[model samples]
Target: MSSSTLGYLARRAAQKERVRILYRRALKNTLDWAVHRHLFYCDADELRAKFDANKHVEDLDTIDRLINEAEASYEKWQHPDPYIVPWAPAGSKFTRNPAPPQGVEIVYNYGKEESD
Candidate 1:
């Protein structure tokens, strides 16, 4: 194939990957806003429908435009206070009790060291 054709194929592949990432992020963001399983399912279905509707587009320019619009929409509607797992990074309980530094030992039995 010609260099132009190769470049086009590469661009298309990148665009497809971006779309996949965007969809996943949007779905996860949706979960942050959904309080119940049924509600999450409904929202997920609607989000899937939106992506499916654009699945058949073959024009690169159109695909790029659609992706941009979808990203913008996602940004505008993202949850203000998203739900985060307590153990995950940036969560409330993350790194609450970090491991001690090297050369430091913690005695579990209270006063036993002094008594000994």
Candidate 2:
């Protein structure tokens, strides 16, 4: 291949990589938002117990609704949130620092902190 062709191919490859990374980051953010919202609005223990007792239909429906609401909220807030990375022109000088998944504090504090 000619030098110009090779350079073009390389640039295209780099652009594709950047696009893939952006897409993956967006998907991760969306999933994290949904999971956090679900946990926030639902009683996990009670839901689990109901599931174990074969009474999960209503709980499942409620969980679905909560997830939908959470997704809507995420979409609304994502544009303005610093934690969410916005799509920029290729080679732009922007750094992405996605927020960590929610509910992490509860897991980290499991039995470690005494309740008042």
TM-score of each: 0.87, 0.32
Deviation from native of the Cα of residue 46 in model 1, angstroms:
0.3
Per residue, candidate 1 scores C-alpha lDDT tens digits across 24-49 of 99999999999999999999999999
State which candidate has the highest TM-score.
1
Q: Candidate 2: give the clashing pairs.
A: none
The digit string of per-residue lDDT tens for model 2 on 1-116 reads 99988976776566446444544444455444454766634544443343345333334345445445544644664534333334553323454554567865425675687779
Clashes of each: 0, 0
Note the residue pairs that clash in candidate 1: none
State how far residue 33 of model 1 sits from its true place (Å): 0.9
What lDDT does candidate 1 reach at residue 33? 90
What lDDT does the true structure give each of the candidates? 0.95, 0.49
